[model samples]
Target chain A: MIRRRKIAEALFKLLSLSALALAIGTLVLLFGALMVDGLGRLDWQFLTSFPSRRASQAGILPAMVGSTLVMLVTACVGIPIGVAAGIYLEEYARRTWLTELIEVTVTNLAGVPSIIFGLLALGLFVYTLGLGPSILTAGLTLALLILPVVIVTTREAIRAIPVHIREAAFALGATKWQTVSDHVLPYSAAGILTGVILALSRAIGETAPIVTIGALTFIAFLPPAPVTSQPPYVSFEWLMSPFTVVPIQMFAWVSRPGEDFAANAAAAGLLLVGMTLVMNGLAIYVRYRMRKRVSW
Target chain B: MEIRETVSISHSSVMESASHRRARRRREFLIEGALLLAALVSVAATITILFVLVFESVGFFETVPLLDFLTDTLWTPLFDDPHYGILPLLAGTIVTSVVGLVVAIPVGTVSAVYLSEFASARLREIIKPVLEMLGAVPTVVYGYFALLVVTPALQWIWPELPGFNMLGPGVVIGIMILPLVISLSEDAMRAVPMMLREGSYAMGATRLQTAWRVVVPAATSGIVAAYVLGISRAVGETMVVAIAAGQNPNLTWNPMEPAATITAYIVQVALGDLPHGSIGYQSIFAAGLVLAVMTFAFNIVGHLMRKRFREVY
Candidate 1:
């Protein structure tokens, strides 16, 4: 019986080691496949060109530009409301029933499926509001998707500020606005920025929500540039322009029935993986810097 | 000279004090109100999602009897003779989710055990972030990986395997949610007080024996919570299943067969152009409603388990 017990323990340890190995091995193999199939395809022309009938001629410029524009709008809309909500929950709201309700609601929202958010946006923004399938519509939908993330992260950052700092500000006769804006927010800016950037990266990787919003799958033309001449030198028309993003483009390629399309899909996935890694790496580095600077 | 300057400063402050205080107070009220409104947007979003789903789904049910929608075996909303039965899709979802859980639970829990109990701090730090990075890799990329890698590998071993089988997507999703399970379960294991392990050691328990018996039992609630959350994610996952699991809604118990999950159906319909307010378009909303309720139920169960069993220390 003692010998059997010892053998069982050894087997369990081996199983545990293999489990970790399986995860890392799978990731390494996935990266290897992507690099082997995709790296040669990525070039200046591939980045600059638009979708083509022939897979070899296709470029991802429009999708890249569209994704950037969407991210810009999403950041602009999501960050302020999300940060304010975080500030309200952490610093301003007293322990009340209403505050608890908001807290619960945000937590639940974080768990709601991204596709449901898409369905809501389809009904509300596309049909009811007549935003059509424009970048603005997709941007607004993504904003809702990432709001809970931003709020949660921002709240954590703000909560980390020492209580003594707030007390010190109060003792000096500074009003709540002055105290938060002048001191608390500035001190927590690095942390909050890190959170915001990470949230945006997640937003970029999301495909289903945008897909459900009826974003044009094939686009040969770019959204009118943010700077175009008509009356004003700057143009807001691009917000209303129909667009396709990188993940959507990748999905389109993957769905097609041919080897070339498969290669194209692999290439697009490689670009997306690169973007996600870079963004996440930046977030980590910023967080590391902040952690190093503040002993508290 | 300092006293004179202080008095002058005080006099100037007093001269502006009443109006300045009033302005500051007004500004505070406005900003507070605005912030409160901003916080309420999440609540508003929840209400909007629920309201839109129910309202649109009601329209769908009016066209197709609610009983038929629930009980029928087929889901062909786009065909000439449309059958709105959601059972096939639900079955597909359940099978794939079960397959995913089968892969994720054991692997994730074992890894968590290894990391929490045996690994040194330095190794733990390096591995944890890599696990997180694994999780954060986009689902679309996972879809590509599932289609190009797992499916082919399976076919090479078993020539009878279908091109777009549930098994492939299910396994990929399991890998995708592994980070979530490891992180959450590891937290639970770590939460099991060190004293428990020491007590087991005092009784001549080996390291494996202490972890398997004492710590595992102590951390059961957290492990259960993590599994529940992982299951919820598997059920809601869209892209991987959509791309790899074939679009045909086949009602079968076999994971090797092609099947359409509820999410896959939603993506299928949305990818095409259906006229707004049509029954076909509303059907996706109906499917969305079902998906929402399914995930929400899982989340509530997980929340309850955590609340009941969470270790305070």
Candidate 2:
């Protein structure tokens, strides 16, 4: 019996360890391969030049600029609304069937395939709204896509506020608004910011929705600047300008029938992976600091 | 004199606070209403998705009989003689997902068991962040990796394997969902009480026996939920299959061959220039409807399982 038990223990240990190793090993292999294939293509010129008919000369400049612009638009659209919704659900909504339905909807939305979001954006924004495959449409699609993530995280952060803190403010004759705006939000700002940043990072690396909305794959010029000679110097025209993003450009390159383009795709993939990792790192660091500072 | 002074003070305060309270109440009501609207955006989005999918698919069904779309063996809408049969795409999705689950389930469950039961606190801390970082790597990147790295490696070992095979993307997606399955199942396992494990041990059960017998059975619902969610992810995955799995809509039992998934089909169509309102354009919405229903059914099953069978420790 003892020998059998020992054998069983040893076998299970090996099995579990191999599983762990597989997970970590895949990550290591992914990054290692990406580095090996992509490093040669990364350079100053790669960042500055435009897409070319030749893969050797093609750069990710327009895609990079477009991605940044789209993220900016996404942040603006997603953050305030998501945070507010989260605050409402946590603090104001009473325990009822309606609240339960909303909660379920949010959870379901989070699990919906991202491609469906692209399809929805294709239908609503590009076609019906006549946004014409612009940056604004792409940004809106991503904003909707990440809304549930932001709201859930924000609700969690708000929920983490100690009850005594809220009671203390209420005991001082503060109204709900004053208490939340002053005490609750200030305390959870770091956590909320971390969640928002992570969600935006996800948006940054997204490919499907943008592609579904017919974003240009080979644009040489940037979107019209936000500020220009238009009557409203802060031009809304840029929002209407057609755009492409990093992942789309990378996908286009990966599909091309040549080794050079594949290498170029790798280079772009490296940049994208680097950006996502950095943002995720920052979010993790913020979370760690928040946990340390706020033990509750 | 004291009675008069008290009366005056009470009267003045009441008069001053009435308008103040009204304004505050109105502001509070307005704020709450606005926030409620914000909260309902998700509900609105869900409604919009359903409406759009159904409304657009109406055109497709009008063009192609619903029975034919469902029963036909081939999906060749892009060809000259278009057949709107969904079987090939459906078969592709099922095969790849089965492949993914076969790879993910055992590995993820075992890892979760280890993480929850055996790992030291410090090890868990280090591993958790690494897993989170892994999950953060985008699906598009995974697609690229699957195409460039995994397929080449597979092709070397199995010379018969096609250039764009289901197995490559299947394995990559399995890895992609590992963190999700691990975290969810770990939470479920950790939720199982320590007393149960202790009881099994008291009965002379070994640690492995306790985990596999006592703890796993106790956390079955959560593990099931995790599996269902993972399957949902595999069913709806887009870029990985689009990039790695060949866009050939073939009804085959083999994972070694290339097959086009519903998602990949949608992507292939979207990449091309189909005029709006054409039957080809509307077919995507039809596909989307089917995909949406599939995911919804899976999610509902998972939710119900978790709700009904979850043990309250």
**What shift in Å separates residue A174 of candidate 1 from its native position after superposition?**
1.3
Q: Write the per-residue lDDT of candidate 1 for residues A1-296, one digit (tens) a residue.
A: 77887998889878987998889998898899888878888888889999999999999999999999999889989999999999999989999999989998897888888888889999999999999988999899999888998999899999899989989999999899889999889889889988888888889989988999988878999888777666677989999999999999999999898888888888898999899889899999999999999865
Error of 1 at B30 (Å): 1.2
Q: Write the per-residue lDDT of candidate 2 for residues B1-313, one digit (tens) a residue.
A: 9999999999999999999999999998899999999999999999899988898999999989999999999898878999999999999999889989999999999999999888899989888988987898888889999999999999999988888999999999899888989998998898898899999999999888899999999999999999998899899999999999989899997999999999998999888988888988899899999999999999888888777555475
Query: What TM-score goes with each of the models?
Result: 0.97, 0.98
For model 2 the local lDDT of residue A46 reads 91
Residue A8, model 2, lDDT:
84
- Clashing pairs in model 2? none
Cα lDDT, model 1, residue B282: 95
User: Which regions in candidate 2 have their CA more than 4 angstroms from the true location?
Assistant: A229-232, B1-7, B309-311
